[model samples]
Target chain A: MAQQTLEVLQSTDLKPKPDSSELAFGKYFTDHMFMMDYAADKGWQRPRIVPYQPLTMDPSAMVFHYGQTVFEGLKAYRMSDGDIRLFRPEENFKRMNHSSERLSIPPIDEDLMLDYLKELVKLEKEWIPTEPGTSLYIRPMIISTEESLNVAPSNTYTFMIILSPVGSFYKEGINPVGIFVEDEYTRAAPGGTGNAKTAGNYCAAYKAQERATANNKAQVLWLDAIEKKYIEEVGSMNVFFKIDGEIHTPVLNGSILEGITRKSVIELLEHLEMPVQERQISMDEVIAAHEAGTLQEVFGTGTAAVISPVGSLQYKDQDYVVNNGKMGETAKQLYETLIGIQTGRLKDPFGWTVMLEA
Target chain B: MAQQTLEVLQSTDLKPKPDSSELAFGKYFTDHMFMMDYAADKGWQRPRIVPYQPLTMDPSAMVFHYGQTVFEGLKAYRMSDGDIRLFRPEENFKRMNHSSERLSIPPIDEDLMLDYLKELVKLEKEWIPTEPGTSLYIRPMIISTEESLNVAPSNTYTFMIILSPVGSFYKEGINPVGIFVEDEYTRAAPGGTGNAKTAGNYCAAYKAQERATANNKAQVLWLDAIEKKYIEEVGSMNVFFKIDGEIHTPVLNGSILEGITRKSVIELLEHLEMPVQERQISMDEVIAAHEAGTLQEVFGTGTAAVISPVGSLQYKDQDYVVNNGKMGETAKQLYETLIGIQTGRLKDPFGWTVMLEA
Candidate 1:
């Protein structure tokens, strides 16, 4: 790989980092960030690492009104050997390009972007927390920066990556949480921005998520927009179900996010010689499986939470408990394996982990 | 209305305005703009009119990631007597409040907001374009300001109003245009942010807009997301069709914006003793009407385009020409009356125009 030189402006007065034990998801960030600019005439230019600070833009920036923005979430793990490593960082860049294309944004050179990311992470390696499930969460995003309020694609863009020291998703680690099935509010419709990890899709689900939280559920389980029958995702993660000892998930439809963690889970299952299949699992099928006592487990997979077990599902005024409102065996096993591989505690059988040298 | 004192930050250096003939939509802005802020603890703060400049925000602002933003568009017309007036300015603020609730953003006091708007408009009255078919476009928007990447409501918000001197919708004025029916891509579904004039809805329509432009059409005609048969909107406007001596537009569903211009058109139709019905009009029915030589006119109504006549429609390789691919009598009459009332050229009977004394 050709070495890309990124100009670094280190923060002379670094702010105190948050205590690892009290870290929340996406609340505390490191001292430096990666930023690059794009213009239609000049393409991408001036890639640099700068102090984590505020950005100023014309009040009439297109992103403020058009929502033409896409983002990716990944993490940097502090391995047992005291070296910072990343899990399938390339996948995030690849998916970022996919999202950029869908949002009519200019593409980023993946190799160069990965190099820039590694450089930033290496400089801020002190922020990665290795206590229990704590790690450094990496958020890379792009937004339209044209200083006008028109409906067309932006001629200027800003690609930025910021680091946040995030705690484990579950305080107790791999604990079960309840999810409310969202029937009234659909997540993504086909031929829409559903497959892309854009900002609008997340905004559209907030009301449903709020209602779910009001109903004492931890997350919202989204149904397909057209029919509202098929299960699409849970909150922002890909969902999988274990029914009668067989693992199943919704196939790669055009209206659901192709999550990296979801793919790794399927690959890990296949590697372990477990029974797994990808198909359309309708809500009716889920309910039927629950009634027949064959629904052994339901879990969500994402970069933030490797595996979040579903203890119960609330749908249409009916509550269906999965494994009696307790965590499942498969979920616990998968979580351990995923994080173990990520932190380099276990062997990298799938070659998924990328190690960064000090 | 309670009078509110707004802090003003006047710009010392004012850029030269663009030529009226060469002015484009949302390109050049005025010297000063209106702004206000909101926080969960403090609620809405006192409004301000600051110099038109860039806004500084943390890169991790919630709007960049979750897209929790809403905006409204209206216009100010300089009357024949040189008096500046707004066309239902209060309605925009009222509708904005509704949009704010739908997106889980905080609401502004409509009366105080109106006062602030009038005060700002009064200060920048020189930017209001007075030429025929041209007016000053007013855009009021609210965006999340919290610098966090969580998928929740932002605790802080920035509400700003910017003005752009725009040229006429058509250089020739009230010309007919063709629209391509979008069958594959969907706009908004039920229980989505369609009825609200939010940022995401507009962004979701961009790809379809690009495809329509590529197809050599002026705009895209959206079909309902569920069935993809019922006509939803034309571009970002409410669609109305004249068939068999009656006017028909899609009824207000949960997934279609309640256009202010649409409401006025319906009221104006009633005042003129025309039979108008707000009901679902399927594409099949439209095709049959065109084949029967009864589809007299098709037009779209919005704040930007008062009335856009539909010359023809391209759907599924079939072309249905409306009014022989020419502007019809009803559309011409509606356009004339709408602009006439807006500019005080015709008598106002509905109390729709808000007069601002210079």
Candidate 2:
């Protein structure tokens, strides 16, 4: 860990800027970025804030061939006092390091990373959108920089942070979306790198997502690999269901990412004096509950979508709508409470927000 | 299909060149290189041969985040008469494009790519190690170049060629290596990106490979995902077993990579009036054959190893040795035949070699 200050390099006039209103999710980026390099001789180098520019690398870098990369996605919110704040920044840092360790990449100092992120947000505060549900999306990534074709852990690496402003995850806001129950393909396996936020996990889920999209669905609801019966996740998000007046979610099975939002929701539920359970929930159980009219709601939690109310699930050619295809009351309460905490409207009793210096 | 002439950025100096006899795999590189760019508006740009220099890419490139990349590996052998020849490079080109299509990345023109490669090998001819069982390894890669964080395909890409001088797949001549059967985790799955020669596939195999190494084995032997009983591939290479005087291999089944060497071996076997069967062979069947002394040989085929003999298989706390834990007659014959065809020592009646101008 070093206290070296960030070296800033602003983008020149030639760099095109996108329209704020027309920002299409992650398709647009900010003017400057953060980067740090790791070599066998020198440890993590002096972190720098530079003009968003192309990285100079050998054609045979290990990351280009072995997929030795990991990344984290979180957002910075604009407060009423014109200040930028990150929600649960420590959680993101912890998860990013966990992903890095799993991918054999070097971990960053949590305090150093938080300080650097705060400085980055303070410098690019204007990029924090004021629109409801809109914010500055920050992507922190680490890649193997060793210039060799051998199949081994890299001796050189680079850690970089890039920002992009995005609109609401649920574009229509609080609307219910359909999901295809993915049984044929597993995003990850037990004793595998599934829990790590690595690039391969997302790539593994793409085919199922493509199939889901082709069928006019939003995402794929993944199942456990062993029997393909137990619900694992929604690929990129953790899932929660309401049945018998209790909030239930699949426990951390090492095959699903331990999402920050998932933890936040569980804590929020417990704080609100609601019954919450974390255990393996099988597909048969869910179907039986739906048939018995006991299945109340289903929603997914992620940084992108604070809460996505699942309207219907298509499994084995059978469709089952949740709560008559409406956003559940529990989902609505969780969404509002979470967003309120993120935007500083709620009390900071949980100590989630890390405000950047103005 | 633009025919813009390729710009040549020749290397300024040869630098400190390594001796051919002491060359390590993927450590030493050539001086000149080939590259091209593609964009949604511009399509595939004209190819180029440039000096071997570091490539400049955006820190936020999709390849860094989503692993939107694929690559191919082949070699350029220096014939006795000083001409350079490639073994079935067309197969490599075709497979690379197939992998790109799966990843949603654009493909390169075959003729143009070959032309660029020829130009590069011609300029860097001095780096080709003139030794038996050794050649200059050629690596071609495609990556997303767009500086965006979107999960979808990128609008821009770069295709580049790099050359690395290598010794041989086996350091101790053509000896047989042992394999550890992996039953818990799968390398690839059905209806997934298994058949594609993508980076993610190789990365996914690393953990299994690590397990094999820790267990003092050479490679990981994969099994079918559905039953975990049938033999599949050994990561990068295709598997083959000689049983009851017949050559048998697992069928493609959409989950196995259609290896070029695998196809070549089948053709060569049929040409020699030998029985070659492409069907499922269960692990139990293989073990039973070994116990009954019917399984004579086991080997793997790929561009890197050409023909790698498997001396033994370790599975379920048991060891099954083939041909008394030594290379079998069939393994030796296939290796000699394939190497002969590649090194210009024997006639390539199939017209597989693509010669490059000196």
List RMSD in Å for every model shown. Answer: 1.6, 3.0
List the candidate 2 regions with Cα displacement exceeding 4 Å. A1-20, A170-172, A183-186, A224-229, A282-288, A316-320, B2-17, B226-228, B317-320
Over B163-241, each residue of candidate 1 has an lDDT whose tens digit, in order, gives: 9999998887566899999999888888778898887787778889888998899999999988999999999899999
Which model scores highest in lDDT? 1
Task: Show the colliding residue pairs in model 2.
Answer: A54-B57, A55-B57
For model 2, how does the per-residue alpha-carbon lDDT over B58-136 read when each residue is reduced to its tens digit?
7778788888788888988996689788988888888898887777777777777877778888888877877787899
Alpha carbon lDDT at A233, candidate 2: 95
Over A1-358, each residue of candidate 1 has an lDDT whose tens digit, in order, gives: 2344689999998989888888988888889999999999988888999999899988889999889999999999996568777999999999999998888899999989998999999999989998878899999999999988778889999999999999877787556889999899877888788999999888788889888999899999999888889999999999999999999999988889999999999999999999579999899999999999999999999998899999999999888999998888889899999999998888989989888886
- Each prediction's fraction of true contacts recovered: 0.70, 0.49
Q: State in Å the error of residue A177, model 2.
A: 2.0
- Sequence-dependent TM-score of model 1: 0.98
DockQ, cand. 2: 0.47
